[model samples]
Target chain A: MKLKQLEGLLGNLDQFSAPKIELEQYPTGPHIASRMLYTAENSFEDVSDKVVADFGCGCGTLGIAAALLGADHVIGFDVDADSLEIAYLNAEDLELDVNFVQSDIRNLQCRGKIIDTVVMNPPFGTRNKGVDMDFLSVALKVASQAVYSLHKTTTREYVKKTALREYNAKSAEVLCELRYDVPKLYKFHKKKEVDIAVDLWRFVPTPTVESDV
Target chain B: MRLLTHNMLSSTIKGVSNGFPLTIEAAKVVEKQVDMNSDFLKNIFSKIEWKPFVEAAKTLGFSELPEEDVQPSLLDSHEFLTKFHHALLEIHLEEGALVCPETGRKFPVNKGIPNMLLLEDEV
Candidate 1:
């Protein structure tokens, strides 16, 4: 399927009702998710036959696309039970063989599984500073290959710098610019749909050195 | 919880390092025949961890899989593919408990959903 075709399919999935503030739950727009998945499919490493994860998967947009694109297996991780209910329903509706795991990604554990790639739209840390980095920190450690994380367009340089200095990242690149619509969930959002700048950042996760080996 | 999901699940609670291949205790098992996609099955063969697949299959009472791992060449066999398809996609655990190997924590599976929520203290 073409990029837009994927977006059309993902666009049909259910969305959140009242997203929690602490989670900073903003679903990745269908267009961005489709384009990112497409790029990942055609770019460096194809998600096909790879164990792909969608961390902070609110209703499983990225992960479902990976499954649709023929990822060997897809797992959607989220802390909220309510979000997971909708995600499971989406997967069931699509008849896709994907699983939703309810857990805080930071504290979640997957022993012995080597995740080939991670596609996630984590919290940008708008309400809570450094929350985005927290997602990156865990993604770097858990993922064996690379992480495709979405960040605010303005923080591209800061994100790239930190990935290099902190994780000794092998490589980092700004894959694409995505125009996200921040839905008015809280009292703060004035407009019904507000367009914002978001960048899809791909990073080669470097596991911390283990001297015990 | 299907074995495909079970294959990827681990207990990621803080302090527990070895949280892989959680043991399954099925209170309910449902069989739903999803259309077979040979192309997808062919691609995912190599990615499947043979031991975990066999172990999980055994727990779910579908022990028809071979004791030894089938190689990449087995992807060509119709019988193998059919069996693989059944084991991977058809079998489903509507209710169960995925037990953490190290922590022995029970993650409940209700109505085919596995709840992996960790307690506040656990996190």
Candidate 2:
């Protein structure tokens, strides 16, 4: 999608609202917020052939972005019904095929289907601390390989250690991080800054498949 | 499962404050195809935790991530976006076991599914 198209979508932000089922409502900034998805899209360019899952997919942004970038299929999971509705509409607007499901990240069951990759922008826990880890736990459970967004300050070491232990996944730091420029309410201020430093982490499962001898 | 979900899970065996970044002992892994939706992604970009996302992708053998410091305009490039999408959404962990950080609890993953069930004692 062209930048103009994206800009147009953002222009209509007022039309978007939290789904009635959403427990909490949050604003996603237009500038800094979308950068992470762009980064994620860059991260997945080479491996777009795999099935992708967007966990804690608020409004299905990451998942939708993956689809736009080239993933053959994208599945988005979230607990908020209102967000899911917006996500679904966004998918339709973009003319991209995506699957959005309303489910909690902590207690999700994927049946038996393994996805190629998983991407998400889970809760940061500013309002609710310790919630980001919950999103990560679910990601480790479902994906063979995955990438996630995290705060630069507190979660750096924790993210690395978690990947190492859970998926045997390693960490490679990305150069450009998205620093939130302002508080959520005053996000439009543009001058105010929140500095939500972001990092893109990759997780690959150990190869258990035996090669032909 | 997405890395975002993995970051929060821990072996809740009684009182383990730092049960995070569960270790994955994947026995089998697979990758499937899915659709794309750019508009949706564009919306959530600011909210993502990119650092850990990159770290997790590397563990999955996806080392090709752009520099975090690069400007946003770079994201407009198809070449850049494609690679980002692959790492963020492609690699899959079909089956594996998740070991808790604090406790040596092993959660089994069957058929690309993780059974995060804890035993009576562990719980």
Candidate 3:
């Protein structure tokens, strides 16, 4: 299926009844999800036949779309049961096979199976500083191949530095940018929708030993 | 929790290194017939560790899975695939406790969802 079509389908997925602000639970827009998947497909080892994980999956957008796009298996991890409830319903509605796990990312662990790729939009730590790093740490640990995460553009230096220095990540790059629409879910926000600059980062664990150039 | 999910889960409690393959103590196991997709089974085959999967299956009382050395040739075998299907997808714990290998902390699985939450102090 084309990315545009998948985005349209993802748009129809059930949303949170009452979105939570603390978790920074703004759903990943379908366009971003599409772009992420498109990059994973053409550039990274295609998600097809791979074990893909959606970290901090809000309403199962990334994970569900991956499954529909032929990820051999997809796991959607979210702490909120309400969000997961909607995620599960959305999966059923789409008739897609996805396992929605309800748990905090910091507390969750994966064992017998290693995740091939992770796609997530973790909190930018606007509310609680450094929480985004927790998501990054967990994603790094779970993924065997690569991680794609959305973060505040201002945090590029810290995230990139930490990705390389602390995690021994071999490759790190800003894949693209998406203008994030922050809906008025919190009291601090006076506007109905606020736009923020977010950067998409791709980090991988191992360096390619053979360089063509 | 589906063993597929179980295969990807470990205990993350404090000071518990090697928390992988959390031993399953299944109080309740559920068997539902999900449509078999051989391609997906094949795709996920490499990711599923053999010993833990066999042990987890046996622990839950689905003994049809072969003991060891699941041959690549067997991956194509319908009979083996059927058994593989049962162990991997069909039988999953509905109510259980995933006991940490090191810390012995028991993460409870209620209604097929394992609560992997740690107390704030544990972090």
Compare the candidates by DockQ and give the number of the best one: 3
On the 0 to 100 scale, the lDDT of residue A1 in model 1 is 74
Which candidate achieves the best TM-score against the true structure?
3
lDDT of 3 at A47: 83
lDDT tens per residue, model 3, A1-213: 887888899888877778888887787888888888878877876587778899989899888878887786688888887788788788879877687677898777776336788888887888778888888887877777788899889888988999889877878899898898877777888999999989989988663333110
Worst 10 residues of 3 chain B by lDDT: B109-118
Any runs in candidate 1 off by more than 4 Å, and if so which?
A206-213, B14-17, B32-50, B68-81
lDDT by residue for model 2 (B14-123), tens? 77765655676656655444444454344334334466556666666677876477456656777766666565545555566777667777776544344564455655
Clashing pairs in 1: A108-B12, A109-B10, A109-B11, A109-B12, A111-B19, A111-B20
How big is the positional error of residue B18 in model 3, measured in Å on the Cα after superposition? 4.1
Ranking by TM-score: 3, 1, 2
Determine the backbone clash count of candidate 3.
Answer: 0
lDDT of candidates 1 onward, in order: 0.81, 0.57, 0.80
Clashes of each: 6, 121, 0
lDDT per residue (tens digit) for residues A1-213 in model 2? 554454445444432353321233344555533455555556455235546788776676667666666666677776665566677777778776666545566655442224556776666666566667777765665565555555554577776676677645544354355664434443344554455566655555443343110
lDDT of 3 at A118: 89
Q: How many pairs in model 2 have backbone atoms within 3 A of each other, for residues 3 or more apart or on separate chains, i.e. clashes?
A: 121
Model 2 segments more than 4 A misplaced: A1-47, A172-175, A186-193, A207-213, B1-123
- For model 2 chain B, where is the 10-residue window of minimal lDDT? B39-48
